[model samples]
Target chain A: MEAIYIILAGSLVAVSCGLVGSYLILRKMAMVADAISHAVLPGIVIAFFISGSRDSLPMLLGAGALGIITTFLIEFFHKKGNLQTDASIGVTFTWLFALGVILISTFAGKVDLDQDCVLYGEIAYVPIDLWITDTGTIMGPRVLYISGSVLLVVIAFIFIGYKELFLTTFDPSYAAIIGINTTLWHYLLMGAVSLTTVASFESVGAILVVALLIAPPATAYLLTEDFKKMLIFTCIIGIIVSVLGYYLASYIDGSIAGAMSTVAGLIFLVVFLFSPTQGVVFRNRRSKLSMTLNEEPI
Target chain B: MEDFLYFFSFQDPNIRYVVVGSVLLAISAAIVGCFTFLKKRALIGDAVAHSVLPGVCLAFVVSGTKNPIYLIIGAFITGWLSLRFIDMIVRYSKLKEDTAIGLTLSVFFGLGILILTAIQHSGNANQSGLDQFLFGKAASLVGQDLIVFGSVSIILLLVVGLLFKELTLLAFDEQFGKAIGMPVKGLELVLTTLTVLAVVTGIQAVGVVLMAAMLITPAAAARFWTDKLTTMVFLAALFGAISGVSGAYISFVAPAMPTGPWIVLVISFIAMSSFFIAPRKGILYKQFQQRKYQKQILEENILKAFFHLGEADEQYYGHRKISDLISQRRFVMGRLKGGLQKLVRSGFLKQDREGWVLTEEGKNKGQRIVKLHRLWELYLTEYLRIAPDHVHDEAETIEHIITPEIEARLEKKLNYPSVDPHNETIPYR
Candidate 1:
């Protein structure tokens, strides 16, 4: 029962992150996602300090706002200050993350969060931190409800904005010509990414959230040319990673989030080398075959 | 107050070690950062920083002790491997650079965490201080750590100095360096090694996460102040050293505070300020220059409108109504009114009951603008062979920017043309 709950928690995070990450990688905003994952640290800490509670709503709102601000700062620096996109991302996220770490250290006693927890997360505790009602009814686990609702919200967002998101990701100029609000959709997508990131931060840690956000989508991208198919593959890969990663963690008696990301990386490596359509090994072999055929004048 | 004095006095050996080690680590990272910044691979430093953790854990597990040398070696190996993996992915796959970096960084960090937690559960008592690489332990820098940091800094500095020219060429133009027979590939490898070394040494002070700031923030801030490579490198080093000392002093004053984040915060503050206020390239300066240029373009357009009106009637000094000027060319009403009033104040125009007329000084300026406009149109049609109709919009923008030197050169180039491609007389003072 505990193993089921833990895997459910991990799968919930993996699915949400994988869905949003599909759009992120499609739009070439993977680093921006990474930046937001780290930059939202201060927002969570500040939210905790102000609300004096570990309630999900306040933390999500705070982290969501910071995530938006992180994107805005990166864009502002790139467009206004003439800084390169990479430097803009590096400078903005590190600064905000540093601020967050400092905030946590200063209120070390008041805040229940620690640097280690933020780095690797405590996914094993998912089955332990139960959600109970005022009527003395016991809920299975808080992480499941939190992550499940988030997955639902992400699904709803994708379903409703499918056309707008698709057009904006593939062809922004055409989308603009057709009178779609590209900037609005961009911010909305970023907002969704941030929401997913903050929600998963508890189960997967901030950095590993990036693995779930990037690796599965990237692997899915290699397997197909169709965007919808890519997204579906990403969710499937996400589930596989969670289940396999959980077992790997238990086998090694190590951090579950860490094992999950390691599995994510391993899966990507396999797909990266073996995907029939896009694999490097197959590509080199195909080229060699073509070269020989040309030389032989067949 | 006494604490501040005691901290700075370097009287205590512990404080001395912390301050010197931090400054050295910062200076080396900052110097390497300038090269990465120029190459626009600043985020690569962040990837290398995150990738070092697994290496650190692996070294500890093998050695069964906290040996600085073994840890540094482990960190450098993984850090370098991460860069290689990113390069390989980008070269072989359709994934872009950003995706490759994010994937590599997170996966390596995740592996590191897995090993670190495994080590902790192994009941290794020596693993107590191993986690310090996550948030850094600048305040706990003992003499042994200082020696490691000092030697690494010296090695980094020496390599950077020796290969300064080759690295600069590699950063600015790799293809050009290759064309000139320079060993561009070899230089890139050397620079990559130096970057790994810098991150490995600096992580002990600022930790793995904020180490990116030590590499990138100082270089970014220094970039706002200069265009020369040498000057930028020096300024970045100076800024890095300042932040390092400040971080050490801050932790000294507040024992509860962590050194790494404060160091990052101070450097970020410096960078943010530089972005806003540094001369020439700073945001405020650019905004100011843009506003001034906009005003000049407005005033010049009004002058050109007056010159066009006078040319239509063969009355250069005749008064023209504001409505007539708008009919000639479009202008925002409020901006036009303000521009007209400002022109009057500057003695460029005279107002009377009928409308406004160009003064003697304004007539020459207006005529010069019209001449430059017609001259550019002719130059484009004759030299570049652009269509006559296409030249108007291009000349309209170029006329505002053409300096007197370019105007004279254009006249000489065109052999003093009298009529533009549109058959309008090229006005002259």
Candidate 2:
């Protein structure tokens, strides 16, 4: 029964990331999401210093605000400084992450966050930190509550703003010409990304969060061309990898997030080499078959 | 101050290894990073840094020891594989380079975590310091580690020194290198191999986490100071060595602090300061240039205004009221007053009870301004086919910047026109 709760918690985080990540992959801004995931470390540390508790509203808000600021700083460097997009993203995130690490080390005793948690995360302990009501009712894991709420928020954002997001991601100039607020949609997507990263940070550390955010959508991208199908495929891949990764970690007594990301990578590798239409094997086989057919005609 | 003295005095033999190891690591990474930075493959360094984790872990698992040599070999192999995979993905798939890098980096790091945690769970005591590879612990710089790092660093430095011209050509123009039959692909392979070796060599000092910073930040900071390849590479290595030694010393003073993050923070500070303060290309330098241009534009505009005012009257040296001059140009009162004072100080204008007027020298200078403006307008209209009405704004900007040589060329090209396209007189000097 506890295993069921853990699976649910992992799936919620994975699906939320998958939903937001689908848009990120389509926008060709997967790296910005990676930047946000790492940049939020300083925000989390500062939030912990203020709240003095593992669970607090200030932590979430701080992470959200810093995530947006990370976006703004990357844009500033990429535009104002005339840097390559990857370079700007690289410079900003590494600086923020280094600062966060320094702060964590300096205040090691005061801060509940540790370097290990920042890297591999404590998702297996999620089921242990449960929330109980006044009536002695077990309300499942609190992480499930946070991550599930974030998933609903992300789904609502995508559902309500689907047309605007689609138009902006595919053709921003056209969206602007048609009177849609393209910048507003962009910030909205970034906002969803920040919220999703914060919600998932506890379940998967900063490093593996990048994998969850990129791998599923990237794999689904190889399998399909339709946008809607891509989103669905990413969610399915995300949930399966989460469950599979949990069991793999349990079997090997390893970090659940790491195992999950490894599983996600394995899934991508499979799709990369063996997808029916886009796989290298099939593409090669098709070419060979065409050659043989032509030779038979001769 | 005492701690600083003790660190630099090198009284402790252990400290000597750390200082020497860090400087070598810094030089190798920075020199290799210069080429990577110039090639616009900066993020590949990040990918390689992260991808080295599995190699380190596998090296430990295979050897059953935490030896630096095996770990470095493992790191190089995986790091090289990551780059090859990235190139292959970009060539074959529709996904972009950033996506491929993010994917490969995260996947390899995740696998490393899996192996590392598995090793930890097995209750292996030797695996205690293995976690240091993640964030790096420079105090663990044993003599053997320093030897490996130092020798590899020397090899990297020598290769970069010998092939300086070839590497520069490959960085700036790959097509040209190929056109010249310079074995461009083989040179690229050598550079990639060196980048992997540099990152692997530095992993024990800065750790896998911040190795990318060690690799790229010094080169990036050095870019602000020079345009020449040799100068940039040398400056980058110097900056790298400085940051590395200082960072190692910092950890010595504050025993609790990690050396990798300190080095990264120091290099980041250097890069940020360079961005704002370096000569020629720094933000402050560019701002100064812009301000100078703006001031020159104001001075030339004032002279042109005086010339226009004098053109209407038969007496070219007559007095004009300060209020009249301000109204003609419609500049703010404060700025106009400052310009008038500056002209008077330079003996170009005089301020008497009547108001303001150009001096004998000022009249000649003002006439020259009007002549350049009208000449540019004529050049724009007659030669460039611009309408006479559209040339004023163009001439207004060009009048301040056109040197006497360019002015002479314009005169020769336009056959020394007597008037502009607007039929205004082209005053002679």
Candidate 3:
């Protein structure tokens, strides 16, 4: 039963991250999501300090604010300092993440937060931190509810704004010309990324969260060119990889997050080598320029 | 203060190993980081730093002991492989470099965690301090660890020193290097290996995650201080050593603190300060230059404004009211007043109760300014085929910046034309 709950939580986190990650990959902002996952550390620490507990709402808001700041600082360095995008990202996240680690060790030493927890979160222990009610009623895993609701909100958001998101993501100018609020939608997507990242941080930690966010969407991208089909493929692949990863972890009794990421990577590797159209072997036979013909101009 | 004395004094032989290991690691990381920064592969350091974890775990799993040599070898293998994987993904797939790097880094790190967790569950007694690889425990830099770090640092530094010229050529212009038959690819491989070696050696000191900063930040900070490659490398090494030793010292003083974050924090502080304070490239320097340029442009425009006023009359050098200059040129009242006062102090203008007038000396200076403007305007219209109307705005900006050499060139190029395309007199001194 605990395994089932853990798997369900993993699946939910994967789906939410994968769905949001597809858009991130399309926008060429996958690493920005990576930055948010790490930069939110101080936010979570501050939220934990202020609330004196890991209440989901305050933590969400804190991580969300930091996520926005991360984007702003990346843009700030890229535009103002004239650093390359990758260099700006490298500087901002490492600085923020280092600060976060220092804060946790300094102030939150009393709390359960430790280097182990931050590096590799124990998803297997999620079932232990149950959401119990008064009079001995077992509600569910706290992460399940948090991540499940996030998954629902993400689904609803993507559903309601499908056309707008599709247009803005593929071509923002076209979306704006067609009267869509592209900037608003851009922030909306970033908001969803922040929320999903925070919700998954406890289950998989920062590094694995990045893996889950980039790997599945990247794998699905190799399988198809249709955006809608790509989204569906991502969620399906995310769920499959999460379930497989859980079993692999159980078999080896290792980290679920680690196992899940490894599984996602394995899936990517197979597709990278053997996908029908975009596989490495197939593309190797063709000219290098031919492979890039379908790609959007950088 | 006592703790500082003890740490710096190195009374304990163990402290010597820790401090020495950290300093060597810092020097090596900084030296190799120069090439990485120049190559625009700074983030690859982060990726390889994370990816080396699996190799460490695999080494521990294979060797069943905490041998630093085995771990280094393991790390090198995986680190090297991750770089290949990233390059392959970028070359073969439609995914961009950032995505490939993110994917490769996290996935390799995830594999490392899985192996690490499996090892932990296996209940090895030596598994203690293995978790230190995450955030690093510098206190564990014992005898054997120092040997590994010291030897690797020496080798990497030696290689960098030997290949400096080749590496610089590869970094600055790869195609040029290849065109000159300099074996660019081989040089790049050597640099990448050195980067991996630096990362592997530094991992025990700063851990996997923060190691990238050590690899990149010192070089970034040094870049602000100099444009010369050799000077930048030396400064970067100096900065890296300071941060490293200080980080280890602080971690020793505060038992709860990890060394990696402290090192990162210190280096980031250096980098941030350099960004704001370095002489030529710093933000403050640029801001000062911009302000000086703005003042120069404003003063020049005021001279032009006075010359324009003098143009309206044949004999009068024109004492114009501040309001009239403000109305004519759209100058702000306070700013225009400041420009007039500055010009008066410089003897370019004379201020009276009625208004301001160009001094006799100022008239010649104004004539020179008006001459450059009209010369550029004429050059644009007559030589470059620009319309008479379009040349005004171009010449307005160009008039302030035209060097005497460029002004001379324009006059020669335009054949010493006496009047602009607008048929206005081209004043010449």
Candidate 4:
């Protein structure tokens, strides 16, 4: 009975992560998200230190705020500084993350936080303290409610901005020329991603959270370029993997998040290699030169 | 300080274990990283570092404890799997290689996190210490660890040494290597395995977050100092070993210092040095050489100009009244004065009681500069697709820097035309 609830919670987290992850993957922000995840550690630590508690409100707010800050800083450095985008992303987040680790080591030792806690969290055990109480009937873990609410917010965020988001992501210049606020859309996209990542951190932890945010949507993208189809495919893949990953974790005493991601990674591999529509051969050929040419223009 | 240095020698059994272990692994990883850095997959090492976590976790689970052998096996398995998955995503999906790397990296790292949290909850002290694998605990390394690492290091080195020729060719020009019937895929796999092994070896000393540096920065730093692959490999090994031992020594001597960040700090220092300070290609050196060349060209041009004025008038055209001519000659006056005085002593110029004069030799030299400058301007306007008025600035620089080889190539490619685009006469050498 409890296992069913764990599956629901896990699936909810997976779908939420995957949906927003599509945007991140499309924008090549997966690594940026990875960096943001680490950078938020210090924020969460500071919040916990202030509140002297591990509950949702302060930690969630703390992490979310820092996540947004990390997003802005990464974008800021890439735009303003001389470093290339990837290098900027790497430097900002790693430095911030290292600072977070050092802080945890120095000050948060009294707290239950460590780099391990930052890396891993057990969703099945989340039910130990968080049980749903409805009409005096004990029900799902409370994480489902929190993650589900955040997921709904994310879904609404995506729903409202779908066309605008697509336009900005696909062709920012065209969107700008057509009078769409591409800059606003970019921030909105980043804000949504950061919030979802922070909300899911305790349920899945920071390190593996990137896999959820990236792999599924990428897998779906390989399956099709149609945004609507891609979203649907990604959500479905997330749910399926959530259930399978949970079972594998339970049966083998392995990690649910790890299993799902590895499975997702495997699915991504198959699609990557075998996708008839968008395979390596096409990409390789295209890069070699323009079409209908006997040889490249040396 | 003297006592510290004396004790720091690997001759002591305690110091021996740490130094030898670090040095051997450093040598192995540095050599592998050299190839990856050249391939421009430097950040893939970063991705692979984060991607091996879940495997390490699973290894613990499979062994029902934090067994080193099982953990290494688990880490290796997942490392290979992660690399394969990343490759597939990049190959098969619409995602860029960066995206795939980012995705796989996060997912694997997150999974590792999940398992570790579960282990912590299970009340395993052994599991708790496994967290150090993420950042490293170099101080705990002992003789047993050294033996294990030393054996693996030797094996890895031998394999790489035997396969160096193929690896170099594969790195330098993949198509050429494949054309020569080299097993590209097989060699690539071997390279990947070596890279993963390097990352794994580093996790013990530098930790996961900083492992990429141990793999990439040494090689990057080494490249600045050498062009030979052999020298680069040797230098990278030296840098890597130095960083590893420095971090280890710091941790050993100072009880609370973590090894990973220190190692990273050292490697970053090396990278910074390579970027600005390596000889020949160093920014300061190049700028210095360029300045020197410009000065030489200016002096030569000035000498030629004075001679032209002299020849055109058959007098020391040193009309002290023409300030523009004097200013134009200002740049080269110092060097040209020496040549001028000799010309006067040998009676090539007469003191006109004005300013200065040039002999016939100076006249001819000045004529060549004027001729070369006009010819280049004409060439730019003609075959090289420059606008008529756009010829001056480029000619100014090219007149200073154009090499003999390029001059020959320009002459031939332009079809040896007698007149330039601007209708200037061609001066054939």
Candidate 5:
């Protein structure tokens, strides 16, 4: 029963991250997403201090706001200060993450969070932190509910804004000509990424959230060309990573989130080596075979 | 107060070791970071930093000791591998550089965490301080650790100094370097090794996570202050050393405070301030330059309005009401009031009870502007062959910017034309 809850929670977080990660990779904002994941640490800490709780609306709101600020700062430095994109991201996220770590150390006694927990997370505790009703009824794990709702919200957001997101991702000028608010959608997409990152942070930690957010979508991208099909494959891969990672963690007696990300990496490596159309090995072989056939005909 | 004095006094061997180690680590990282920042691979430092974790854990698992040499060797191997992997992925696959970097960074970190946690569960006694690599242990720097840091710092500095010219060329233009018969590929390999070494050594002070800041923030901050490569490198080293000392001091005073984050925070503060307040390229300075130009354009446009009113009635020095200036051309009322006052103060316009009159100096100034406008309009239509209707807007903008030399050249080039494309008289001094 504990294993099921943990796997289900991992799946929900994975699927949500995979959904958002698809757009992030397509838009070439994967590193920006990585920046937000680390940068939101200060926000989470500040929110935790103010609200004095682990899981609350204020925590998500705080982290979401910081995520948007991170995006704005990166863009601002790039466009206004003339800093390169990579440096701007590096400077901004490290500063914020450092601030978060300092805040944690300052309030180490009061805050239940630790630096190690912030890095890899405590997904094994998902079954332990149950949500009990005021009427004395026991509910399922709180992370499951949080992650499930986030997945649903992500799906609805993508579904409702599919046309705008698709057009903007593929062709921004055409989207602007058709009067779609590209900037608004850009911020909105960043906001969704921030929210998903905050929700998944508890189950996967800050850095591993990046793995779930990037690896599965990247893997799916290699397997297919269609965006919708890619998203579906991402979710399927997410589920597989969660289940395999959970067992791997239990077998090794290590961090479940860590195992999940490792599995995610392994899956991507396999797909990278074997994908029929895009795999590096196969593409080279196909070119060689074509050259041979042409020579034979000559 | 006494603790501050004592910490800075460097009387204790522990404080001396921490201070020297941090400053050395920071200086080396900052110097190498300038090259990486120039190459526009700033975030690659971050990927290498995270990727070193697995190598670190594997080294500890195999060596069963906390030897600094072994740990750095392990970290270097994986850090270098992560860069290779990112390059390979981008070269072979359709994935962009960013996606490749992100995938490599997280997966390697995840693997590192798995191994690290497994080692912890295995109950190895030597694994006590191993987690310090994640956040760093600057305050706990002993004399033995200083030997390693000092040696690494010397190696990094020596290589940077010896290959400064080649590295600069590699950073600014790799293709040009290759065109010049330079071994650009070998140079790139050397720089990559230096970057990995810098991160591996610097991580002991600022930790793996904030090590990127040590490499990137100083270089980025120094870039804002200068355009010269030599000056920027020196400034980056200075900024890095300053932050390193401050980080050590901070942990010294506040025993519970971690040193790595504080170092990153101080450097970030410096970088942020540099971005805003540095001269020439700074945001604030650019805003000031823009405002000054806008004000100049505004004052010139107002003066041109008076010149137009004078041209209409053949009264070059006639007094005109403020209302009359508005009737000729629209101006923001508040800004127009300020512009008119400024014109009067500069002796361009004389204010009287009835209205405002152009002074002798103001007339020449205004006449020069009108001539430039008409000359540009004629030049555009006659030389460039633009339509008469399209020449007005072009002249309107060019009239404000045409220097006296350009004005004289335009007059000579247009053969001293007295009439513009629109048949307006071209006033000349």
Candidate 6:
């Protein structure tokens, strides 16, 4: 029952993150998500230092701010300074992250700052802390509720700003001139991303955060072109993997986050090989089959 | 800084092994890196670097001792598998290049981590330095490492020397090489082998992950200094040598500091300097050219005013009110005092309380700028088919910078047309 709650919350978080992640994928800012996920460390560290505790809302905001700054620096270098986008990102996030590591070591000491914790979260245990409510009635794990709220917010924002987001993703220059505040929207969208990752980090961990953000949405993308359908399929895939992943991880006695990520990875692989629209194997076979049929004596 | 390389000599047989080992490793890896950078395949260095981690761990698990042969073989196998996997994912899926890179990078590395933790939890003391491959573990290069590094280096260099011409052709243009019936796939395989070898060699010395920099930044920096392929290869080799030697010396001296990050620091410094200071394509040179052109534009405006002064009234001869002559440019009056003073010393113009005017030499100089400007306008409007409204400003910039060869080419291309798009007569020299 408890594991079921963790799996549900985890999948909702994946769905929420993936909904925003599709546009991010097409915009070629996948690494930007990677950067934010890493840069959020300092924010997490600083927040704990200020409130003298971890897991606070303000810290999430602070991390969100830093993530946006990372985005800005990436933009500044790639656009204004004309640095190659990938290299600029590589330098920025790593430097900031190196600094964060140094800070945690220097100030926080090695107590809670293990590298494993940074890479993989203890998702199997989320149900233990988050499920029991004040009423003593099982509210299920509350992260599922929080993730549900975030999903609604992201889905609403994506809905309201669909045309503008679509235009910016396709032709930024055209979008810029058509009176859209591309810069403002870019940062705001990045903030939503930051919050999504930081909020889910406790449940999913930092490294696998990108898996949830990228994999399910990318799988949906392979199956469909319509944005709404992509979002729907993205959520369905997210849920299926979240549920199946919990059972699989328990079966292997592995870390839940690892199992979930591997599950998402496997689903992506299946879709890439078997999806009728864009599957590599399917496409190649279809073409070969068609060619053979054409050569037949009819 | 120069003294640091001295601590790193292979002279004392005690250190001789390390020196002989480090130099060969650096040189060969760098030579291979030059091609990787040229192919714009630097990030593949990063991918291969991380991908080899599982190999290193697997080697430790299989061999039961830190034998160089087992580790190298293990690292190479996984490293090779990663390259193949990266190819498969990109060829088969919608994963973008970086996405594929980051995905493969983290998953392999994470899996490596999980395996390593399992090893550590099992209480194996020998597995201690294995994670150093993440960044690097330079201080651990003992006598055994030197032999491993030396043999690999010798083999790498032999491969590079044997296949240099083919590799160069492959990097420069793959399609042309293919169309010419060259061995594109074999050449690509050779290049990948070299890259993997360079990456694998650095695991014990520079470590694995940061070894990518030893591959990437040196070649990237070397690119800015020269256009010739041979010179680029030499420069990249030089930069890589500096990183290898300096990083080793620092690790030796500091004892606690890792060699990998230090090597990256050195490579980054060298790369940044090249980006800003290289002669041909450096940012500073580009800025200098732009500034010089701006100064020349101002001088031309003065010259144009003096040319107009040639046909003005006698009363205005000595007292040409600079105000009447000031046009859309409008800054001529403000800065022309010092410029006109130089012109006067050059015996090209005269200036006094009656205002300013032109001498014979000054009038001739002004006529030349006007001639270039109008000629450029005609070239644009007649030959290049620019709109008439756009001709003037386009010519304004072009007249100042176009080389004599360029002017000649434009002139011949336009067939020496006497009149411009604005119907102004072009002055002939």
Which one is best on lDDT? 1
- Least accurate 10 contiguous residues by lDDT in model 6 chain A: A108-117
C-alpha DockQ of every model: 0.80, 0.66, 0.66, 0.23, 0.86, 0.23
What TM-score fits each model? 0.93, 0.95, 0.95, 0.70, 0.98, 0.83
Candidate 2 lDDT, B89-145, residue by residue in tens = 777677888888888888888888888898899898889889888877777786888
lDDT for A206 (candidate 1): 82
Off by over 4 Å in 2: A78-82, A132-138, A289-298, B313-323, B330-334
DockQ, cand. 4: 0.23
Best by DockQ: 5
Candidate 6, B1-429: lDDT as tens digits = 544655644455645555556557777777998887767666677678767877887788888877888988998998888788778878887767766665666556545554555566567888777666765656677787778877898899898888889999888899999999998998999899888898888887776645666776676677778889899889888887787777777666666665666676676677767767788667677678777767667777777776655535433244565665675246645576666666678787787878777777777677777778888887666667788888887777777777778878877887887877777777666
lDDT of 4 by residue, B241-326 (tens): 88778777766775565577666666667655664667875545666777787656755566556655554565634543235456
TM-score of chain B of 5: 0.98
Residues A1-298 of candidate 5: C-alpha lDDT, one tens digit per residue: 9999999999999999999999999999999999999999999999999989986698898898898889889989999999999999999999999999999999998988998889998899999999999997888899888899999999999999999999999999999999999999998899999989999988899999999999999999999999999999999999999999999999988889999999999999999999999998899999899999989954
Off by over 4 Å in 4: A1-20, A28-100, A108-113, A121-168, A171-204, A232-298, B1-12, B64-67, B91-96, B123-128, B254-258, B280-373, B381-397, B403-429
Interface RMSD of each: 1.1, 1.3, 1.2, 4.3, 0.9, 3.5
Worst 10 residues of 5 chain B by lDDT: B136-145
lDDT per residue as tens, model 1, B1-429: 899899888999889888988899999999999999999999999999999999999999998888899999999999999999999999999999999999999999999999999999889888997888887868867777789878999999999999999999999999999999998888989989999999999888788978999999999999999999999999999999999899888868887677889999999999999999999999999999999999999999999999999999989899898898999999999999999999999999999998899999898999999999999999989999999999999889999999999999999999998899999999765
lDDT of 3 by residue, B313-365 (tens): 66447678877676568887788889889999999999888788889888887
Task: Give lDDT tens digits, candidate 3, residues A119-227.
Answer: 7776888889989888889997888998999999999999999999999988889899989999899999999999998989889997789998999999999999998
Q: Would you list the clashing residue pairs of candidate 3?
A: none
Model 6: pairs clashing at backbone N, Cα or C within 3 Å: B10-B16, B136-B207, B319-B354
- Assess the local accuracy of residue B13 in candidate 2 as a C-alpha lDDT between 0 and 100: 94
Error of 5 at A225 (Å): 1.3
How does model 1 score on DockQ? 0.80
